[model samples]
Target: MTNPIVNLFAFLSLLLFVHCDGSDPAIPEDHRFYETMMVDGRARTYLLNLPPDYYKTNEDLPLVIGLHGTGGNAGQFERDYGLTEKANSAGFIVVYPEGIRSNGVLGVRTWNAGRCCDFAMKNNIDDVLFIRTLIDKLVSTFRVDAKRVYVTGMSNGGMMAYRLACEMPEKIAAIAAVSSTMVVASPCHPSRPVPVLHMHSVLDAKVPYNGGKGIGGYYFPPVDSVLGAWSAANGCAVRDEIRNDDDRFKLTEWLNCTDDVMIQYYLTRDGGHAWPGGQRSGNWGDTPSTVINATDLLWEFFKQFEAQ
Candidate 1:
């Protein structure tokens, strides 16, 4: 299992990312491509970035799907989340699934993500099924390792990632939720235990870390309560540990969980309702945390597990 080539590959990948400026994660194109598929009579779209030298390999690669917040599209998430470049350097396939433009409140693109978002939520969009079907297709076409499939997203998209892990635990190996908390209705009965890594900012007002309504006067459940539910579901020990990293961010972990699953959170003191260690949401979004790059943390967490 100890391969020098693999270790060197990982080292070079990290080196490439360290040299990148968090504010600008976009890389030159050629390997990035978009694809559309019909799900439930509606045309769903997604953008994907393949790893460098992808064509030369017969190996099955891990797949990571990044979802954007409300008012964001595949391209925005692809850029803002800073996952595409990671995909290229880290040798994993990355996909950005687009949300539908809503006709209801907000009147903008959003994921249903259970009962927590606009448009998609109001209309009862089958985003869960759409994502499931998309995963199936992508896995078949790209030789993806189904057990290594992972999901990460921001805001509403992060909530959607929670929904997927809750409803389709069999398909998702793990999930990393950013700047968002679990808003899915109670009784989040997953078929099996799911590993979850949540990252948020203490200063995030859009989705406050302590809970209550945030942006657009939307109600958000307490982040601790949400994590508590997941830990309890995973049969993790009651006690949790919290560690401070030079006053920049606090790391909390539930050490003993059933199935050797990991349940942890990274609450950064810097940054607001935006991704930590990446560019702001858009031109007018909040500044990202300089203490840590979320993309780096997400991948590090994701690489540790596969579907159990």
Candidate 2:
């Protein structure tokens, strides 16, 4: 033999390299990866975070689509929203979808949530289709549980979440909106009753709690109006029912709805337009509430329902 020991050493070295390089051969071999798809003949980009042991098993994990607020990009939202860490711990996959950029800025972007946004709204960008197609693409590319797809966002992104629920209820199992309200002028209608969870702070300057012009100069309807619309669309017996209460926050819900769907809202006395228990966006960003971990609550809510 030329060199049997050397050959064994080389083989071991090759295995080490393969282990370090993640030789899974999956479309996304890394835990945190990127993928691009075409929607409306336009290139759309998204960042994906898979659970740490994702490639270790053949599990079909649930997917959570996180949308950024106005003037935000996917990376920034991913960093500040605290979803990736939650995904790792909860054994779910989370993706942050980038919105179309505004003309004046490089990274600043907005979503076409129906109305009251900047570039995307003015151009009437097809964000709804983008998200719907994104879900389909994820299902095609990854081992995602199609029936357990959930969506969540903040501010403008949250409004976009509302829009998606209104337009494509069948594709989504449930939705949770934070610091957002339905700004779509069209009447609410869905193919089926979709479960909803909403969280807000009474003191939020942007997306004001009682309805009025926000710090972004966008006019909003009262929270009651938003809940009323959702309740009626889901065929709830009542608009709001007090479920729980605390000094820092109050829990309201709509339980008696068609198909047993439920709607829950959390109004916190503290905090502003920020993700509850997430890192504050910036030095000047609103302080998130400390009472509840939204990531945990949303996952708890999301795990209960599936698309039927």
Candidate 3:
């Protein structure tokens, strides 16, 4: 089935933009709510952005949890991904979780991601449990629609999203992972398969699209293998002849057992291992040289799914 709204946007210019604070670009919020959460007896910080309409609406709003990559904090997520502006306009509550670092490791913060990140991967820290606990706390305190919770992330964060799908499918409705490959190893499948949207650049030197080991001090699963795993779990059919606008990128949308459960694969021609249109800095290496707006693409994909 064709998406009437997305079809309309296809002809029109896709305008993706961002809003950043002048100073402290890392800390994306000025007056947003935040908290320091203790996970596994460690102090971790997270920023919460309640929509302006949060007070006005009687109905519960959807919640989106964002995870940052290694060597990044929540602030970088806010400014780099342009999620603050996107969340503000969409009227959804956005959560940014900070990764914990071990014993004074300079510029190193990573999620265990099963195969990578020595501290997270080797120590057997249960990040899925932490995220579940965090969601439980948020739902109790705020009027979050439990059925509509979503997750998105970059690199390590992307891997975490895959882990969450495997571990907490009932809790998360959908996920969007950018420039990151799946890294969790689980024989068990999701209790309820969730929708997934994966975007990656074919030219990504860090995480190869064709599926080999990851470069730049990170480990990840093969993209095709991960998709195959999800397909088997969800019982989705593989489609030939991809649907896309141009050769710049090719998109394959898979419909699972139910129409509600969908998965999309976006293969970019020469895009790199970075959030499209994300902010640039000397500290954060491999920022996409091109100016593509991933925030807009994420929202466009996210808007299509509703809570079960």
Per-model C-alpha lDDT, please?
Answer: 0.80, 0.80, 0.71
lDDT of 2 at 203: 80
> Candidate 2's error at 37, in angstroms?
2.1
Q: Candidate 1 regions off by >4 Å?
A: 1-30, 104-107
Q: What number of clashing residue pairs does each candidate have, in the order they appear? A: 0, 0, 2
**Ordered list by TM-score, greatest first:** 2, 1, 3
Candidate 3: worst-modelled 10 consecutive residues by lDDT:
13-22
User: Per-residue lDDT for 1-308 in model 2, tens only?
Assistant: 55888654433321210011111112456677776788998888788888988889998999999988876666777667688888999999999888876665233467888865767888889999999899998899898999999999888888899999999999998999888888985877888988999999988877887899865456877877888788888899966888778798999999888888899999998888888888787555788888887888889999999987
Q: Candidate 3's C-alpha lDDT?
A: 0.71
Give candidate 2 regions above 4 Å deviation: 1-29
What does candidate 3 score on TM?
A: 0.84
* Candidate 2, run of 10 with poorest lDDT: 16-25
